[model samples]
Target chain A: MTAAYYAAVDWGTTSFRLWIIAEDGTVLAERRSGEGMTTAAKTGFPAVLEAHLAAVAAPAHLPVIICGMAGAKQGWVEAGYLDTPAALSTIAAGAVAVPDVDRDIRILPGLAQRDLQHPDVMRGEETQLLGAAGNLGDGRHLVCMPGTHSKWVRLEGGKVTGFSTFMTGELFDVISKHSILSHSVADAQVFSGEHPAFLAAVAAACANPALATNLMFGVRAGQLLHGATATDAKATLSGTLIGLEIAGALAAAGAVDSVCLVASGSLGALYRAALASLDLSPRIVDADEAVRAGLSTAAQAIWPL
Target chain B: MTAAYYAAVDWGTTSFRLWIIAEDGTVLAERRSGEGMTTAAKTGFPAVLEAHLAAVAAPAHLPVIICGMAGAKQGWVEAGYLDTPAALSTIAAGAVAVPDVDRDIRILPGLAQRDLQHPDVMRGEETQLLGAAGNLGDGRHLVCMPGTHSKWVRLEGGKVTGFSTFMTGELFDVISKHSILSHSVADAQVFSGEHPAFLAAVAAACANPALATNLMFGVRAGQLLHGATATDAKATLSGTLIGLEIAGALAAAGAVDSVCLVASGSLGALYRAALASLDLSPRIVDADEAVRAGLSTAAQAIWPL
Candidate 1:
């Protein structure tokens, strides 16, 4: 398959990314923009696509694959998700093609939990799973994807068996900025995850797991009573929230011998550190790389010429 | 003591209040400005006093008493609190008199918990406690002050037995605006605490008071599974958090035979309502009225001409 150009789009709530790649998956050009699903209501889907395309010197007929919250209800088009125990073939078949795109475009359907009493959905992480499958050679592995809406997925032989979502990042931001914890957290200490107090906090949350509420109060009480620094309290709040998420996710996913972490950004590293504390040192992989490999897989499945 | 003039000031962190009162504590003339402790850096103590005094029609030697966050560290001057089990005398002794004013000005000292291993401080609420004491009579009662920082104070015979602060409102705002709960909450359904869903949520939180983190996940899960409305979920999250706080506060304050709740806003009323489900029927009193009555008590204490 000697493809002249390949394009992969990682579009989510906050941002959009377009990668112009060769057949070998080496990037030829890349474009990033502020036009994501969150801003898509104002920017419109066609405009978002056009803006990214305009930034890169790519052919009009380049085969394109997209992932992430771009397939959410508020995204460009609602490209639905495959239920748990999903097959790669079924996922590929479920891809919702954009009606009027110039090139061969396949939007990767996300993974969802439909077998349960109530259905939970995802949109873009399936691409990441495919990317992990391509790299890890298809086996039962615990995949941890950490973000604002962190996903813990179980992948077996290139198919997603089950997954759980943690509101870790969102909780961290809220507790630190809006709760009693905020009293001890200044905005300047937003990235203070490495502080010793932070690790102590993480350990505390992971210890009781049920004391998440008390843990938050402890931040304020620690400062008021124990003279814990505002910075330390802030870090503790962050660590506790993340630690709780880790415990919750692990419980939901059941125990696994090995953990394969699909992580991105500094926050993901924080999660990796948290998982490590819980005796689960994950095989870390960058989300960007995974999504790129995922696009490659999806591209191969569609235009295998 | 035939008083020609009277003055009452409700000074807080972010704002200052001055009221030219009658002998009966009727606010004949009142003025409020943004000269709170937050903006006090730009405007000094002298400036704050001058700005509000300038609103008066005449300069008389009227006795004035103030309360609230103005006694905080960054206020005009730190009006330190009286240690409990203390009474009006304790607070009066600590009152800091402001000089160079044409009138007798006394800043009321707030309440501080020095008995506990970890001290808890509260400004302005002491005056409210005085008012509540007057209204409820000298007996054991619980007061729930709801705001960004909600305080549940235990009082017995005009003395504050103990208190605990919960960041319920702030947490609600943060989770509803920043967390996954944000998705399940609409901007419109924030304050309708009487919603059936809100009561159900209160019950759910009360059921496992310790499982707040897991219970929060239930908001998103409930929405996904049961077609729960965003407003309902939002209210549920709010109820759950508040309910947890109630349970925690009740435990911390020790068991009570009866509860007479002194609450101010609709939010406070909602908290009272939530507590009611636990068979704790609280006799709700308006917080603002409590403050007014409390201010009158303070004025009487300072003047006593």
Candidate 2:
């Protein structure tokens, strides 16, 4: 049997996932928790990591590799950022080692596009991009990593030319819970990507990207005037924001040889359906596998097996 | 002293303003309070209005003419809506008198555009439109009533052809308080409409309204990369939303012979500057005077002196 190797971790703002991988790239153990950067910041990152490691019975000296907000300025250690027009391979090379540890530990730096007209930054998603890029062929590719902040990357050859971050997920969340539209979508049930209201809203928002707020208001107006259901209203809000993000993403990219969606679960399915409606078929990549692959890549480079 | 002929009230969602008018339409007394429809709904609209009426020494028999949320289904009484392209003059005639009240009291009906493509509803702004439209010379006029839900009415020959409601103000409020960007703008100070950040953001949003969420994210990126101030972040948020609104309003209205802005106070100044930056010098009409004029128009029609 292959010996247990390094531990790979994806530590987001509010989530933490760990995978103990064998030297042969097999997962020996896995753990997930709500103790992300925010929680770990107060509870202590070293203790949090030890507790999760102990649960999985991992080696005491097992090397660890982390990405995401763990490298944010306010997180464990500020790993900093790599300027745009950066190569994917350089991602692993930019890993910053955490000091005074029993075993080797490193956090990957994020990517930044400092253009005066269009500035943007991404921490964990860059690692996802690094792993997802290997799945894509050469030439120009539009890589979309959707989350609380959806990132649309302009990748050419093997380099990240630039990227844009759309607050689609966050906007949907705030609007659904805090805005006047909250009343309209409060009792919303689970709605699929194929829901008519969702499809229609996606199309309407893309049709007139400028009328986003107007279309959002239509969610409430539709309920009032046409008796649209709470589920439908929720779907509409989600669809409208997603559509606007797609419209802007596509518009900014101009033309791409292929579009790659690096997302997992429900969001992935939703984006696939939305992309299909817009006459584009994206090459789908699982976010979980991609992040793990990314961590493995950095692990291999740091501690050549 | 001129005797009070009728009391005109503009009861909004979160505010209430009243004026005692004489037989010759002279202002006999005025009252303002936070007792809007939301507060009055729970505390009793009649009691709220009676207290204000008594404070102004209003005569026992003085009829009240109200226009706003007081007429909503959830307010004092349901005044319903006048379907479009309804004449502005019909708004006064559509007033629903309060049943069982000793004195004659009526609430004006709101305007509703029932078009399947652009369904919209406006409660109090119809009265403002009725007042502001009179300021226009004729042909075609685009009336902008900025508020929580800014309404842009298309008026042609004194008729409200159609309108669109943008959730601009409310979006600003929710996003400022509920999103990740909230941290970036939490310590923001008062920024004038003339702030460079405001102008730059307005230009950028108008240039690519499709990229609104992206541009909004730029506020944080700008701060991270360029050390932008909290005031600039706040201004950017305001300008971006306003710019997107103006872009959509213009696109929806098409070509109009004249543009009129019916707003008061600081919001009015902000919109004016935003419009001016876009090379639009809209004819200004005070919102306070407009609502009073609208109530008086309905009052004169209901209670002829």
Candidate 3:
């Protein structure tokens, strides 16, 4: 069997994943845990990484390439950002090395849109973009990466012209748990993309994004006046947020020929359905694979086998 | 002072106000407390009302006219709703008397827009509308009542055409408290409508209401990348929500001659400033006075002396 070449880690705010890859680019071992940057920050980033590395039985000298919050200012090491307009290939050049470590460890820098008006910053998603860029090829593509903070990137050729982050997932969470709509969706049964309420909300919000909050309120009113089920309320809330996101993204990236959605699991499915509902079939890219591929690309660039 | 003739009360979701009126229709004594429907629901609504009434030194036989959440199905009595296109004068006639109560207490009905597409209900704000209608007269007036759940009413010839509720204030609260933006506005100083950040955000949101959530995210991004102040973050958040609400309200109302702002205190000042930023000078009305006037209007109609 080929020896492990390097370890790739996606250290997020609340999740940690590690992959031991062979020189042949095959994943030899894998590990995942909830001890992400948040936990690692408290329990020492090195210790947490070492524990995960040990769990994967990675070679002692196996170099590691890390992305996401581990590179944030509040993460393991402060890996600064690359200001846009930036080339996806240049991300490897901005990777920051951890000081005084036995094994070589590098954390990829984030992207910063320093436009005084917009002034957006992204940590982990840049890596995903780097990986997804291959699938997107050299064209003007609107890439939607759905997550806690859903990012919509405008990529021209291999360069990221601009991007916008919608607080979709986070807003959904806070709204459901903290807002008055909480009562409307309490103990809601699991719903899917095909939900009537969800589809209708997506259509309504995409049509009139101005009425996003009003539509959110309708979740409660619908339950009260229309006897809308808990699931209906939940679906409506989800669709409203997702729909507003799509509208804003479309508005920002005017007349895009293709949309690349880099997402995983249920979230990806949801976004795909929403996009389809809006008469757009986005090019699907598995986010998990994209991040791993991105980390591998960075690792190969830094330590070519 | 003349003996107390009737007690006018505005019982809301989180607040309660009582005004003892004399035979001359003058406020002889007044009481205000946080014993709103929420508190009353847990601690007996009748007891809470009696405590406030007794504090105001109202006569036992004095009739009481109440409005707002006290008339909700979950409140002291189910006063029900007056469906649209409802005449402002019809609100008093639909008042539901508190069954088996010592006093002749009647809680005024709220307004319900039962359109299946946009089902909406308002309690206390309906009373405010009832009073504000007298001042507005026969016209196409867009009434913007800014609060936790801001109600934008469309009145055509003293009859309610329709209305929309923007969850502006509640969203601000939940987003500021529970979302990542919480860090951006942790110790924010009190800011008003004149704030440059506030004005800019208001302008941005109004112009591009579709980008409401994105604008909301900018509060955090601005802080992280542009070193935006806490006050700036807070003001920006305030402006974004209010501006989006205004945009939605205007879009829903369509071609109104004038905008009527019925609000109180700093919130009123804030809305006025937000409206002015968009070149809209809304005719202002005190929310407190409007509710009182609405209750008085209902009182006179229910039990004409």
Candidate 4:
């Protein structure tokens, strides 16, 4: 059996994921839980990390590299941000050590854009960007990382020049559950990116991005007038938001040498489709693999694997 | 005492307002209550109407002209929508009378844009438009009626050509209370249009309407980084949403001969500031007076003195 070199943990706002990695960059074991920063803050971050490591049979000597909300001000430690125009390589060097712990544990710092006009921040995504675009001998790259707060980063010459955070995912959630559109999409079933309503909405929003909220109103109005199904309303809502994100991202980034989408699951498919609908096909990278790779890179740098 | 000609009631989703008028168009008495359509639907609508009438000592022969949610499918009578491009005069002709009532009570119908691409409906705003812009001769007019669901209507030659609804107010309420930004704006104080943060946000969103959601995220990021006060965050939010609404409204409206604002109170002031920021000085009309004028016009049309 391969000996574990180190452990990697991606701690988010409401989720926890850990991987026991071998010396040869193999995942020996993995664990996922809902005990993220919010849960760990209450139940003890050290205790939670230890329990997960023990369950995975990770050795005491196995150094752990952490990333994400675990380093937030409200998290385990204040792993402060590295201001923007920041090189991707510095992300690994900026790993913050978890104090007074026996194990060699470190949490990576996030990225912050301090522009008063466009203030923005990202926690786990900076590391993800490092792993996803670290090796690229780039001119310029537009990296889209979708989540509760979808981030669009402008990477020029392997450095994050600036970035914008769109409240797309969060808005989708609140509008669906709390707004008047809730009634329209109350009975929505699982839908894919290829849904006609979704595609149509994407096209509409992309064509006229300024009519975003008006387009959103159409979701509910369509249901009332045309007897549109719940799925149609839900899909339209999803398409319109994703479409707006893409429009904003492109308009903000201007021209890019290449575009990369680092996302997974249903959201990845939707974004992929949204991009494709606009006649742009970005290089897709799996989000999980990117985060794990990021941790591995930072871990190797910190502990000299 | 002058004989009461008719009572004009603007029955909204959660608000009720009744104005007693004499045949000579003189104000007799006015009543405002919380018994809007929602409450009147539960308690008998006729009873609610009667109680208000009795409070003002209105005679049994005093007829009633109702507008807004009272005419909705869920209200007293199902006053169906008149499909656009409908003439403003048609609204009064579209009035549906309440059945099984001794009093001569009629509810004004709303306007519906049945266009597949942009489905929209306006309940009380149609009457407000009629009251505000009913006599505009042979020229196009853009009327903005700001409320919970703000409506921007395009009136051409006294006809309801088309209109768009921006979920600005609803989105603001939901986002402030439900999204992650809630933490940033928890202790927000009441801010007006004159606030610097509000004006700056309006300018930002107007400059790049696509960056709307990004600007929204900036509210939280600004709080996290700059220690922005809750009021600043709240004002920024308000400005961003209103700016997006204005941008979308203008983009969709193409161009018009004149712009009119039919609104009241603080919302009106904020919109006025937003429009002024974009160098637009719309003809301002009080919403209450406009609605009353609309009802008066429709009432005279229905039951001539």
The runs of at least 3 residues in candidate 4 whose Cα sits more than 4 Å from the true structure, single-residue gaps closed, are B134-137
The sequence of per-residue lDDT tens digits that candidate 3 reaches over residues B167-252 is: 99999999999999999999999998899999999999989988988888888888888899999999999999999999899999
For this target, which candidate reaches the highest DockQ against the unseen true structure? 3
Going through the candidates in order, their DockQ values are 0.18, 0.82, 0.85, 0.83
Q: What is the TM-score of each candidate against the true structure?
A: 0.78, 0.99, 0.99, 0.98
TM-score of 2: 0.99
For candidate 3, give the lDDT of residue A271: 91
Model 1: how far is B235 from its true place, Å? 2.2
Predictions: Cα RMSD each: 5.1, 0.9, 0.9, 1.2
Q: Per-residue alpha-carbon lDDT of model 1 for A166-275, expressed as tens digits?
A: 66777777676665566678743555446677777788766655445655766665665457777776777778777776766666666565688887777776777777
Q: State the C-alpha RMSD over the true interface residues for candidate 4, after superposing those residues.
A: 0.7
- Worst-scoring 10-residue span by lDDT in model 3 chain B: B52-61
Q: Per-residue CA lDDT of candidate 1, range B1-305, in tens? A: 33445566777766677777677556677787877777866667766766676667535556777787667666766787776666643566678887776667788887666543334667887777777777666666777777666677888776777766666777777777777677678654555657887787778656655345656766786676567777777777888787777766776677654576677667776877787777777877787677777777777766674
Q: Kindly list the per-residue Cα lDDT of model 4 for residues B90-162, writing each as its tens digit.
A: 8999999888899899999998899999999889999998899754567888999998899999999888889
Residue A244 local lDDT, model 2: 92
Tens-place lDDT per residue, model 2, A1-305, is 78899999999999999999999999999999999999999999999998999999888899999999999999999999999999988988899999998878899999999998888999999889888888897999999999899999999988999899999999999999999899999999988889988988889888888899999998888887888899989999999999999999998998889999999999999998998898989999999999998888888888997
Candidate that beats the other on DockQ, 2 or 3, i.e. the better one? 3
Who is ahead in TM-score, 1 or 4? 4
lDDT of each model, Cα atoms only? 0.71, 0.91, 0.91, 0.91
